[model samples]
Target: MAMLNQIEAFQPENGASWELYVERLNFYFEANDITSADKKRAILMSVCGPSAFVMIRSLLTPRSLNEVAFEEIVSKVKEHFNSAPSKIVFRIQFHKRSQRLNESITEYVAALRNLSENSNFGNTLDDMLLDLFMIHNRCQIAGSTSNGTNLHKGLSAI
Candidate 1:
């Protein structure tokens, strides 16, 4: 079917998302009314590609891929490839990062956003980003000869 053709092979080595690939595969099954367990497993095994296949083989250990149920295989692969990071470590990185010289505001913000992804910022992400941006900018302003009172005052308002 047309939908099935859209499924890209899962390749972790290439930075492809196993989560997204599985999501799309699930969508494919829903769209095409593919309810059979064996058929789903077959399609998954075929589509997951070489790199993932090798990973699956290793993760399964003594048991062959055939010995596992579909859900078990999916669980093992997802856990292996998409394991969550330590929140403290990610938060430290997020806090420690500052804009590099020659980096534009857009690039710096993008980097901050990327670093914050696993920071567990939850509801305070926006406020934290604003605070970091302001502190770094203030430091930059202070290092220059120009008066930064106006910027300091503005930042103090928050």
Candidate 2:
């Protein structure tokens, strides 16, 4: 509980504020041989969720996450996980936004992949990948439909 609180506090409000938190988390993640799936999930979910949202929103902000900043974020996250980021993470995080709601997820996953690749955190990266898959599934299940239909037919399908 205490550790979780500390971790929450460590998260930065924005990219510029994340430098120190990223450094400390990286150190802890590297020093410990993390074997727990839950821990990995927590770390990635906490870091990636806000990060993805921020990166996407940053696109429209006055000062945004440029290529250099994006790469820096990725590097830090990778160091924490201690593995090369998988391509799936890269596809989600770094790819330019698409027309759908998934644009944010894609950018954040790319950041995770970039960071993991530099740092070499396989287990952590794997955990992130798994979580991303689950999250994607949940999103699809929540909003997706089998066929195109108008409001009346859509309601009938439901």
Candidate 3:
């Protein structure tokens, strides 16, 4: 698969690229049909960067790596990278997100999409609510300065 080829070439940078690494790793696993935990663990350890490899090795020092489950290693990595406080901070930032002055609507929405993906806010209702909030709060019409109005009015005037 094209994605599998990309993952085979991928070398994650420590600290700065963990999220992208996990995302691509998951894609690679799915693409290659690697469902066995042992196989998954083997590939994960092999493909991860040196720093991440060392960290995971240290974390598994007390246990036999061969005996450990894939999910357990994934859990440890997720916990290490996405701590509780950081998740809460992400949530708060997502809730308070706004389009900056001179920012286009497309840019704002793209940013929000990324935040929503990383924040794990998978609820359709929450996504709809955020979309509505952004529309009502940030959808400024040209030559108009109104608040608490429907977006249709702005679109109609365009």
Candidate 4:
């Protein structure tokens, strides 16, 4: 139980995923032989940070924390913190993601991949990614113009 005090409060804005935090907490319980459900609940409430604990309290309003089981608290917190974003929201971000001027193709592709994570692109993910990359790359190439003079001059010569 003493060793379990090392568990840090989860801050989603700090880039720590809830899944990873839960995984670590479970492993800590296993290592320290803290199997008591009551203890787990107490530890979770104590270690969940002040803001989250307040939120948890609100989530259980009208219901006493003592009456609520460990699983219930964990489930409620997980639902609120780990809810998935809408697919349309993800797709909008993915579509609006244009490569920055200084960003390399590799970086741009990686950004696209990250943006596409929850996009529900399904089996066409690769196809769509390739198509966007090609289109954007072409635009980047031909998008340049010296008052349209160079392009027009070259075309006139041909």
Which stretches of model 2 miss by more than 4 angstroms? 1-5, 9-16, 35-42, 47-73, 76-158
lDDT of 1 by residue, 1-158 (tens): 55445566787876566677788889988988889877888788887788788888899989977778778888898888667558898898889998799987667768888878777788777667666766787334334423334433433443
Kindly list the per-residue Cα lDDT of model 4 for residues 19-107, writing each as its tens digit: 67778888978988989989988888888787767778898988988888888887887888666678998898888788798886667
Rank order (by lDDT, best first): 1, 4, 3, 2
lDDT of 3 by residue, 11-98 (tens): 4342244557667788878888888889888888777757678888787788877878988987876776665346567666677777
Best by lDDT: 1
Question: Which is the leading candidate under TM-score?
Answer: 1
Sliding window of 10 residues with minimal summed lDDT for model 3: 6-15
lDDT of each: 0.74, 0.45, 0.64, 0.72
Ranking by TM-score: 1, 4, 3, 2
The better candidate by lDDT, 1 or 3, is: 1
Q: What TM-score do all the candidates reach, one by one? A: 0.60, 0.23, 0.55, 0.57
Where is model 1 more than 4 Å wrong at Cα? Answer: 1-5, 14-17, 81-83, 92-117, 131-158
lDDT of 3: 0.64
